[model samples]
Target: MALDRPTPVTFHAPMVLAVGLPPATLSRAGVVLEPSGVALRESNLLDLRSDSAKYRPLVLLVDAELYDFDPEAFDMVAQDVGAKLGVAGSAREAEVTLGQLMAALARKSAFPPPPSSADAKTDKWDFSEVVAAVAAQGGRE
Candidate 1:
């Protein structure tokens, strides 16, 4: 769906290690999944497990905004399609995304939808904040 948001969101925190490849960065905004894994960009699901192949797993680290719309059901459909494409992985943390699919979401709109009253106390950081922090720590996005 549309990637507009009030703040930023950190989509994933995967620490993938591979020889000769730069670190991969990933995050999610709305239904858009952006992986800064440019080195492994050429490798798709079918060739994922090969030693010489470069690819990252599709992992979900958050389940909020998209879940307000029943993300599990949406993930089921995604899983089915991924399976057909030889992509294997469990849907953890609950898979969800906006109905309108986009390639990527803007950084400012990365913040997840507002939290519920009970969950509002949880601490959250915007995507740019995290990215800047990571960059300060020698991590590229």
Candidate 2:
């Protein structure tokens, strides 16, 4: 009697795409694509302070060929929305960059926490002292 071998299971992590490229082009890049609108929706959902943990591994893919592309702004928006951003001129490069980012994220997730310092001190200030300090500065309007 022969034993059956276990089947390989594939895992697909959730991702958000904000690229201007066609779906066909992005699909060819080996990335599981979600609509750019989802990114906007996620942003709004986050603004409402709703739980979006289901949307983990979210990334904003931007086509670097765009005429008015602002990488700095894109990065800021991605950070605000708690998502990663990757910009590439070509689909192949985008795939490579995304893979690298995923690997880096994985490594970061496994990192050990920093050791606590035994000499750390917590400063406790008196409320009356704070009021007196404020009054010395001419007080609030």
Candidate 3:
């Protein structure tokens, strides 16, 4: 019996939202700043954690020095939600970081694909065929 391979899950466009930074600055850096300052809310965290795969990768640009922010809380939430946490001391630095983050996100996967059972079943030896072809060509193998 033939086994069906499950379809891969396609996530939506990755989002980069910021807190404590002007929308204009983030826009210049190619990121859309979330208008609300509710980044630490339970509802947002829950949604982020539950629907992480449905949405694109998230990077939250936080200016803790300028705002009444909790770095530990943000880090925990980011980890739980599979999001990246970036901290900037000033608006200028935030812009620079956001730009860098955007560039990194645009790049393709940095890691290799995971091993799977399907890989084990795939044909591994092509040397015999190569040897036969070489012999037919009256060439040394």
- Ordered by lDDT, highest first, the candidates read 2, 3, 1
lDDT of 3 by residue, 29-94 (tens): 443233312122112444544544344246666665633456676676567667787776665776
lDDT of 2 by residue, 16-71 (tens): 54456445446644442322222222233233222233344367666776514456
Backbone clashes in candidate 1 total 5
Q: Tell me the whole-model lDDT of each prediction, alpha carbons only.
A: 0.33, 0.56, 0.56
lDDT of 2: 0.56
Which pairs clash in model 1?
Answer: 1-100, 7-111, 8-110, 8-111, 9-110
Which parts of model 2 have CA positions greater than 4 angstroms off?
Answer: 1-14, 29-57, 114-141
Q: How far in Å is the alpha carbon of 21 misplaced in model 1?
A: 22
Worst 10 residues of 2 by lDDT: 36-45
Q: What TM-score goes with each of the models?
A: 0.20, 0.45, 0.48
34-114, model 1: which lDDT tens digit per residue?
Answer: 344322123222333452222232332222343344555435533543321111121221122211222233443587877
For candidate 3, which ten residues in a row score worst on lDDT?
34-43
Q: Total clashing residue pairs per candidate?
A: 5, 0, 0
